[model samples]
Target: MVLLEMSIVPLGQGESVSQYVARCVEIIERSGLSYELHAMGTIVEGELGQVLDLMRQCIEEVAKSANRVTCTAKIDYRQGVTGGIRSKVASVREKLGRVAGPN
Candidate 1:
């Protein structure tokens, strides 16, 4: 799985936080990948290649607004696990015949 964390700064248009977030949400939804949009960031999780492609598309869509927007996307990725870090660790424990301890 791949997770992308992005911070977008929009310039010249004085775009509200809500507007910026809404635009990002729209782009993410249009990408057809499962995503979570937050007040200051977005999280996208999916297959590596597809997520990367969609991230690029998202950046491009934001760029098209003609508002002198600049976006920085920080991506952290893991392979072969869809349920994220905890699930990955649990799977490893299961394979090793040891149950995961309580958090």
Candidate 2:
């Protein structure tokens, strides 16, 4: 089960947080994938690729309804027990150390 962290930035239309989140939930449901949408402001999480794709589609649909409306998405996958991507990368770096220059 892949976990994803996403941030969606809505433009143009003055959409409330609840409204935007509701729209996102609807889109995810339509995608035929099981997901959980957390209401913690801008950031959201769920299944990896599926949720992100649905979020993009929802944003597009919303934009079509409102002039100049657009949204940007950022997604990151969770590695293991720890949630943060930075923590995961740091763990990897500690194991690998710095690479030597090619001779």
Candidate 3:
């Protein structure tokens, strides 16, 4: 599986971008990909092609109402690797001898 940390910004939108963010997240959820929403962005895990397609869909969807849209994505593609979203965090916490907790 591939992991993507994606942040979509709708330019020209007012100070609060909750609407656009919600819409983008709606797109993510509708795609049926596993994801985690964070303060700065969303993390999605899926196949490479699907994740890229999702990014394209996000840009296009936001562009429908947004004058300009900026998308930032951090992709982690690992062959024969899966489920890094939760496990990766757990690995680090284990190394630090700590338990999982709310962020």
- Assess every candidate by TM-score: 0.66, 0.47, 0.93
Error of 2 at 97 (Å): 32
Better of 1 and 3 by TM-score: 3
Q: Can you tell me which runs of candidate 1 are displaced by over 4 Å?
A: 85-103
State the lDDT of candidate 2 residue by residue for 1-91, as single tens digits: 3445443445665656456667766776666654445455234344666656666687776665565544545556554543443344466
Root mean square deviation (Cα) for candidate 1 = 5.4
**Model 3: colliding residue pairs:** none
lDDT of each: 0.71, 0.55, 0.90
Ranking 2 against 3 by TM-score, winner: 3
Position 20, candidate 1: lDDT: 60
lDDT winner between 1 and 3, please give it: 3
- Per-residue C-alpha lDDT of model 1 across residues 10-83, encoded as one tens digit per residue: 67766565666677678778877767666668877777787777767766666777557777787777666575
Off by over 4 Å in 2: 41-49, 68-103
lDDT of 3 by residue, 1-103 (tens): 8999888888888778778789889999999999999899999999999999998998898899988989999999988888898889988998999999754
- Global local distance difference test of model 3: 0.90
Worst 10 residues of 2 by lDDT: 79-88
